[model samples]
Structures are given as C-alpha cells and as structure tokens.
Target: MPKSKFNVGDKVRLNKRAPGYYGHLLQRTRTIISIFYDDEKQGNTYELGARGRGGSLGFFRSYMLSGVSPAQASKIGRPKTKRSYKRR
Candidate 1:
C-alpha cells in the first residue's frame, strides 16, 4: 500500500483552491488526528483538530488538505485530547 499524504499529528491547511464552502477553514491550521481509508473509492479521508480546541472539526478528503511546514506544525502544537468523564 502507498503511504498517505498526511499522517497523524501532522499539521495541514485547507487548500486555497478549495470550494468557497470551505472558506471558513481556509485560514485555520488543523492537525491530522486520524485517517480513514475507503476501499470502494480508493481514497483517504482525514479527521482534523485545531489547536486549543477539543474534539475534531470533522472529516475531510485528502484533496482538501495540504501539508504545512514542520515549523508551522510546531507553532500550531498538538490538539488537546478529550477527557472521558464517564466512570470506569
């Protein structure tokens, strides 16, 4: 299997050429928290998270996200994991 374009913990930005519907996300840098592959379509979808925000924004196609520089990733830092409130 080929390697995915973006990996977990990698920072990415929505493609500038993406549709206007994604305009709200254009300026925000998001981190890749998880990836989902669809066998039927043979494509990858990513779950994104923003710094300082808990939980993920949503899933997006690989084509919609672009890789940011490692420097930029460092600046964005990692997304905070959601804590489980339920008792064991």
Candidate 2:
C-alpha cells in the first residue's frame, strides 16, 4: 500500500465490507481524532472519532474509515466535558 495523505482532522467513511462492520460506521461526518504511526514508526495509522448520539456523554472511535477527506473535518480542540460532582 502507498502512504496515506490523510491528516489528523480528516473526515472519512469506512470501505464497505462483506459482513463485519460494513455499515456500523456512522453515516454522519466524524472528526479525525488523530493519526498514529505504526510501532516501528515506519508509516502511519488513522484514528477517527465522533460524539455519541442521544446525549450519551462520550465519544466514539470509528472501526474503519474511507470515502472522505483530510481537509473536510475541522481540527479538534480540548474536550468540553464538565467535571463530575462526585468527590475523590
């Protein structure tokens, strides 16, 4: 495979598979969390994420991604979650 040109905030869709995770990937556009390099640090890996639906209070990572662009998704800032009320 050739080197991927995707950036950290790229938006992507997963390539359709036969059965496993074929359609599970969210249709809504998701923000790229970050791109990771292989353990050997030779090439790179892609990490895609999005906010959970229905106020679930969490972000979700995409199992796989395709059909998108690195310039589409905006860069991510710090998380906006508030501190919990429970004490230490």
Which 10-residue window in model 2 sums to the lowest lDDT?
Answer: 54-63
| lDDT tens readout by residue for model 2, 11-58 | 666554323543654465665566655656466666556454423212
TM-score: model 1 vs. ground truth: 0.68
Q: Tens digit of lDDT per residue, candidate 1, span 1-88?
A: 3479888999999886666786677887889998998787788888999675788878888888888886633336555775759878
Q: What is the lDDT, from 0 to 100, of the residue 82 in candidate 2?
A: 59
In Å, residue 42's CA in model 1 sits off its true spot by 0.9
Once fitted onto the true fold, the runs of candidate 2 whose alpha carbons sit more than 4 angstroms away are 1-4, 17-19, 40-42, 52-64, 69-88
Q: What is the TM-score of each predicted model, taking all chains together?
A: 0.68, 0.44
Q: What is the alpha-carbon lDDT of model 1 when measured against the actual structure?
A: 0.81
